[model samples]
Target: MLWWRQDDDERETDDEVEVRGRSVLVLISHYFPLLEVLDLSYPLHCYHGAVELSHLKKLRKVNFSGHSDINDKSLLHLFKSCKVLEEAIMLHCFDITFDGIAKALRERPTLRSLSFSKTNGPVKVRYESAYTTSHFISSLSLKCLASLDLLSSNISDELLSSIATERLPLTRLVLQYCIGIVQVLGICCNIRHLNLSKCSMVKLEMNFEVPKLEVLNLSYTNVDDEALYMISKSCCGLLKLSLENCNDFTKKGVNHVVENCTQLRKISLDGCHKVHANIVSSMVSSRPSLRQITAPPTRTGAFSARKVKYFLRQGCLVC
Candidate 1:
């Protein structure tokens, strides 16, 4: 049996390419005994027969995103099948539950990355009355977890807080379109990259520490000047910031961040109707380190074609 593959082939792109039927899945396990990665990410997938890859022992990563048939039992079976599974992405797998995830965590303590972003529906706790909800969620103590994406997943603040308490050294976090979460940055202090776009329920209040943070996305959220100020104060090391379509903040908030985050290299403000052309231009002029500015909406006057070309020539891009 192949313990590990040296490189990835074009056909098996981390298991991304689709397979038509259950027989194919079983055939893969039988022929390619050492299949380390499998990605079956698709859209609006109709239910199919289940063929658990239980015979495999070296499977490292798998993507079950957009599969409706892989429910709680199937998720546990998949994780248990892989001996050294490092990453598992089950986005839009509506049938998965917190209980399933809790059991799955026990089988993969070395998992480095996990995403349960269920866009189809919310993941719930099965046998709700029997299991302690907090205990079930707190079981997400993956010893090596680093990157987590819960975009559009209806997870409560308690579950998020549990991760923070575990103090897992998470470096990247994405919760875009997750309406249930209220406070993001507080729980993810160690995260270097964070995406909170379209999370209207978020409220940024009080000062916190996330000094290691480098990238942040607040596009289409309810972020205002006060929140921006707090972010500027907390994450001084931020390099790339996106505030696309965030109408609450004006030039004042933008300038505050620009002046504070000296290391900021890229700022994207596309769809922002309130920000004027001059503000973006001023950002370019003031910050020598600034390399790119995604200018505000065209209605607010995006940089002219000539001006864009001129700026690009000078090592800075304005568009």
Candidate 2:
């Protein structure tokens, strides 16, 4: 039941305290069996304490992100102990390899939201193989997993294709900066919120259908007018869309979205040079449901600015 640390007069150096404090915490876990939520993220070197996590059967949510010492063995111990675990965020835990991640997923079928991105260590040799990564994702049981974030990872298009084929019941997926994904050929039909920002290789002809999609972000990508048109046509239920720095799109693409995506309440066209001022004005006039529209100051002036002001007066947010 010891909750507080010793007085400052008796405290050791930071390194010694951190190392020794973790050991104390692990020892305390043996006494307090009801410990449910544990966050060992940032600055806490839990290389040894992680193994002791198996003792907390009541643990539900855990965050082990940015712990340099957390490896597959630590994860194995965690999954083995926290069978009822629901959410686990392990971003930048460099020591965790794909094998460890796969094993954890297999053991904890109740994980609903999981993030393992940016976990690749400084040493490139520790990176997981594409095959192992793909196998783990595809093999995930479709009962509990609903949200997954894999930003800045080395996941390839082949793995994406496998995920598409598996069609797991994922609702939200983030794949920002995943350069290896060149196309998304209708793999995630059930996805409602999707972010593919900075995926430079995704081109105009890349075909994909996500009918239930509501929120989509394709910022800083190579998505052109044709691709935007395709998205508007397919994801008609889209409520929020961001195309920031997507310079390949023009007025034609914006028009398609304004015309088709009637459910759209918010849209961002910042850094888009070809979407003229008049087109934006036209869109504002047409789409009464539009609440927020973010565009460059140069393109949003005179008529567009006046329309935005009017919307603001009417209690809508237009920027």
Question: How accurate locally is residue 137 in candidate 2, as Cα lDDT from 0 to 100?
Answer: 75
Model 2 lDDT on a 0 to 1 scale:
0.74
Q: Give a tens-digit lDDT track for model 1, residues 1-68.
A: 23212233334432333444555567767888787887766633334533457776788888777787
> Which parts of model 2 have CA positions greater than 4 angstroms off?
1-15, 27-32, 44-47, 119-128, 203-209, 299-307, 313-315
User: What are the per-residue Cα lDDT tens digits for candidate 2 across 117-235?
Assistant: 66342224234577887877777664677888886676676678777776767888887766567665466667898888876466434355567989999998888888888988888
Clashing pairs in 2: none
TM-score of 2: 0.85
For each candidate in turn, the TM-score is 0.86, 0.85
As a whole number from 0 to 100, the lDDT of residue 36 in candidate 2 is 73
